[model samples]
Target: MVARPDLTAWRPAVAGVAEVLHAHFTDHVYPMHAHGTWTLLIVDDGMVRYDLDRHEHGALSDLVTLLPPHVPHNGCPVTPRGFRKRVLYLDADVLGEEHIGRAVDGPALDDPLLRRRIHQLHTVLAERGEDLEAESRLSLICERLLGHLGRRVPPPPSRPDRSGLARRLRDLLDERVLEGLTLQEAAGLLHAHPTHLVRAFSREFGIAPHQYLTACRVDRARRLLLEGQPAHAVAAGTGFCDQSHLARNFKRIVGAGPGWYARAVREPASRS
Candidate 1:
C-alpha cells in the first residue's frame, strides 16, 4: 500500500510517541504495505481477519494484534461493523536513539506484556484527543511501552549483515535525505529485491525501508533541535523539504510536533 503523500500535514505533539488516526474504520481494508513502527491493533468492537506473515489470526475485542515493523501483510473485516483501532509509531526508548538498527527481532508474538503496554499507550492516545499535554502523556505511555517491552520485545538481532544494512541506510540518508531515495536504492545496496528487502528488513529490524528512513530523519532532527537549531534548518539538514514539511512528516511518524519535541527536550536541560 502506498503512503498518503500529497496532503499537507502536521505533527500532533506526542512527547516521544507518535500515532496515526484513531477512528472506527468499518469494512475498510489495507493491501500489503509497510509501516515505520510496531503497530498494536486492538479490536474494540466486532472482529477482523488478518494474516501476519503466514499466521492467520482472527481478530477479536480485547485481543491486541501486534505487527512487528516492516513485515508485509493485509487484513479484512470478519464482521460488517468492522473494527476500531489506533497505531502508535514511536516508543520511548525516546525513539530508539542508541543504535536503533541494533533492535533485532527474536520472536514474534510470544510476549504478552508488550501487548499490554501498547494497549496502555493506546489508551492515552485515545483519551488525550489532541490536547497540549497530549504528547507528554503519549511519551509517558511510550516509556511504559518500551519499559514493558524491554525484556519481552525480542533482544536486538546479532547478525552483522542485518545491523550493518540498517546502519548503512542511516548513514546514506544522513549524507543527503533530500534525494528521496527509493526502497529500490536500499535493496540494491543490500543486493536484494524490493519485496525481499521489505520482508527481510522488517523481520530483522521490525520496520520497512521507508519507515526506517523516516525514523532516522526524525531522530537526527530531534538531536539537532535539542542543540537549539531552528526548525527549518534542522528539517533541511535532516532531508525533509522544509520546516513545515519536516514538522508534518515528523508528527506523522513520531506523533509529536517539532516545536513540542524541542521545547520538551530543552526545558529539562535548561533546568539543570
Candidate 2:
C-alpha cells in the first residue's frame, strides 16, 4: 500500500493572511494538532471528517469551516477516495480573539456567499500584482465572517448619495490606468472602506472595479495592436501580467482574440 498526497502552500503578499494551502490526500490521517492562526477551510472533493475541541465535525464541499487559533483538531478523509481541500490561514489579528469562542462553537458555516468569496480570494491570491483585488475581497470576506460569528452589527439603512464616490473611483482608475493603485490606496484617497468602495463603484457603474480595470487595459491593448505594436509588447504596456492574460480578457471583452482583431482591422486596408 502507498499514500499519495498532493500539496502546495504559499504565503501571499496580501495582509491578514498567514498562509494558503491546497492539498489532496488519499490514505492519510492527521494527528491532533493546533494552529496559531485561524483556519479558513473549504473542501473541493470528497469529504473531511475532523475532531475539534473533542467535538466531531464533517467538512463537506458546500460548507466553509473555520477552526479557531490554538484549538486542537485532527482531520481525515471520510471516504476511501480521500479528499481535496483549500485552506487559508488567517492572521490572529484579522479576527479578534473575542470571536474565537463563537467560531469554535460553530466551526462549519453553510453560507454560500462566504464560500464563493473565499474561492474568489484564492483565485486573486494565485495571480501576481492583484493585491488590491485580493485585499478588497478579503475585507468583505472578513466582514461576512464577523457577521456569521454574531459580532458585526448591521449598518443602519441610509440612502446617502454615492454617485460621487463612484465617479471619483472611476476617475482614479482612469488616471492610474497604466500603473494601477491598490484598493487600499483608493480607499485612503477617497476616504472610504474597501468594501464600501467596491459596492459604490459597482452600484453606480454596473460593473466591478476589477472588471472595469481589465476592460480599460484591454481597450488600451486594442489601440496598441492597431498601431502595429506586437501583442506581447501591448500586453506589457497595458499592465497585463502576460500576453495570455491580455488575450483572455481581450477575447472576453472584444469578442475576438488580440491576434484576430489586429488582423481583421488590417485586412480591410489590404483589400483596398
Candidate 3:
C-alpha cells in the first residue's frame, strides 16, 4: 500500500472544538475507538464504511456523519483508491445531551442543507480565528443540526397527554444538569423511549430537555457571577466545558458577557 498525503491536525481558534482532520487514505483503517466529543465528518470523495453502536453505516461523497460521544466506531474505505474526509471534533457539552441519542442511532445523515452548513463551518474555522462571523456560523450550524436530530412533533392532539412527564423530566434535569445527564440515561430512568420523552418534554415545557439544561446552567452561572465568581470559575461550577463555552452561552442567554453582567449586578447593589 502506497502512502498518500494525509492531514490530521487541530484548529485552535474555535472554542469547544477539539480538532480538525483532512485525510485521504488508500490502506489505512481506523481501529475501533471512541471519542469523548462529537465527531462531525464530511466525506469529500469516494465512499467509506463504518459502524456505530454495532450498526453499519456507509457514507458517500458529500454526506454528513454525526457521531455521538462514547460510541465505539471503526472506518475504512469502500472504494479502490480509498476516501477523502474532513472532520470536526466538537465538545459534546456544546451540543447538549438531548440529541446525542439520535446522532448515535443515525450517524449518517442525508440532509443537504446540514451538509452544506457543516462544510461552511469547516471552511471558516480553517481560515480564521474565532470571531463574530465564525460564531454566528457555528450557531446556525448547531440550530439546523438540532432541528434534524431533535424530537419530531406531529399535529397537536385535541387533548395533549398531560401525564406530567415533562414536569418530572424537568425536575430530573434540574437535579442533574451539573452532572451532565444524557438523553439515554434519562429515558432509561423514566422507562420511556428517547424520542417520545423528548417530544413530550418539549410539548409541555416549551423547550427540549437539553435546552432546559443549558438554561439551568446559564441561570446558575448568573447567580454565581453575581456572587463575584470569575467566568472561568463559574464555568466549572456550572458544568460548562470551559470559560469560552460559558461566555458563549451566557452572552446568548443573558444578552451580555459574564464580566459585564457581573458589573451590572454589582453596580445596582452598590447604588442601593
Candidate 4:
C-alpha cells in the first residue's frame, strides 16, 4: 500500500495537561526525542513502533502507549498506509513520579475499556466541552489508569504513620493545589486532627503542609508557562489569586518569574 502524506495538529493545554497532538504519519519517523511531560498516546489506525529505554514496543489500536516524562523514545508507523495517532502531554508532577515509574516499567497497556474511556475523554477535550464534564472524565480516567497499572491508591489513614498520612497528604495537595484546600479541610477529609496532622506532616516531610502546597502550585505554574501560557492566565489556572501572586511564589521557589521561566523553557525549541 502506498503511504499517505503526514499531517499534524497541536491543541492548547487543558487543566493539568500541557498539550494534545493529533497526527497522521506515513513514512515519517520521530527522532530520538523525549517530552518533558508524560506521553499518553492512542493509535487510531495501523500501528506505532517505538523504543522506550532501549526496549522496542509495537502498539496496535487496542492498546494505549504510555511514555513517562524524560524517558527517551521515538516512533514510526509499522505499516505502509502509516498510522493516525492522538497524544496527550500531561504535566508529570501532577501525576506523581512514583505512579509514573510503575507505568514506565511496562509502557503499553492492553486494556480495551480503558482505551475507549481515554479516547472518549480525549474527544470531549478536543471538542472543548463543558468544563465540569471534562473535569469529571479526566478524574475518572486518571483513577482507572492508576488502578489498572497496579499502583495502590492510599486508603484513608487507618493509622497515620503506617498509612503514611504525610504521603497521602502530599497527593491531596498535588491534586488540589490549584483548586485550593485548607488545612482544616484536608485534615477533616483524612479523619485527623488539624494541628496533629500539621505536626505529623512537617515531621515526615520536613516542610509545612502549606509550604508543600505552595511548591506544588509553583511547579504546576512552571509547566503551564513552559506550554506558552501567559503568566496571568497561569496564575488563575494554577489556583493563585492573581498574576502577582504567581510571580511572588514562582520567583521564590523557581528562582525566576513565570515569564522568564517560560522564555527559558521555550527558547531552545524556538531556536531549533
Clash number for each model: 9, 0, 0, 0
lDDT of 1: 0.57
Of 3 and 4, the candidate ahead on lDDT is 3
* lDDT string, candidate 2, 159-238, tens digits: 35478888899999999988887887898999876778888888888998888888899989999999989999998999
lDDT string, candidate 3, 1-272, tens digits: 46866877776555567788888887788899999998888999888899888889997876788888887999998878889888888888867766888888777778898888778777766653223234445655665667778744333223345346677778888887676666556657887645566667777878766667878899999989888988899999998878887888789888999989988874454543
- The C-alpha lDDT values of all candidates are 0.57, 0.88, 0.75, 0.73
Looking at model 3, the pairs that clash are: none
Point out the higher-scoring one by lDDT: 1 or 3.
3
TM-score of each: 0.39, 0.90, 0.54, 0.54
lDDT of 3: 0.75
Candidate 1 Cα RMSD (Å):
14.5
lDDT of 2: 0.88
What ordering of candidates by lDDT runs from best to worst? 2, 3, 4, 1
Candidate 1 ranges with C-alpha deviation above 4 Å:
1-10, 91-140, 147-272
Ranking by TM-score: 2, 4, 3, 1
Residue 175 local lDDT, model 2: 93
How far residue 269's Cα lies from its native spot in candidate 4, in Å, is 68
Candidate 2 deviant stretches above 4 angstroms: 128-130, 153-161, 267-272
What is candidate 4's lDDT per residue for 67-127, written digit by digit as tens?
Answer: 8888888888898888898887878864666766687688888888878877876776654
Regions of candidate 3 where Cα sits further than 4 Å from its true position: 151-272
Measured by TM-score, the strongest candidate is 2
Which residue pairs does candidate 2 place in steric collision? none
Cα error of candidate 3 at position 125, Å? 1.4
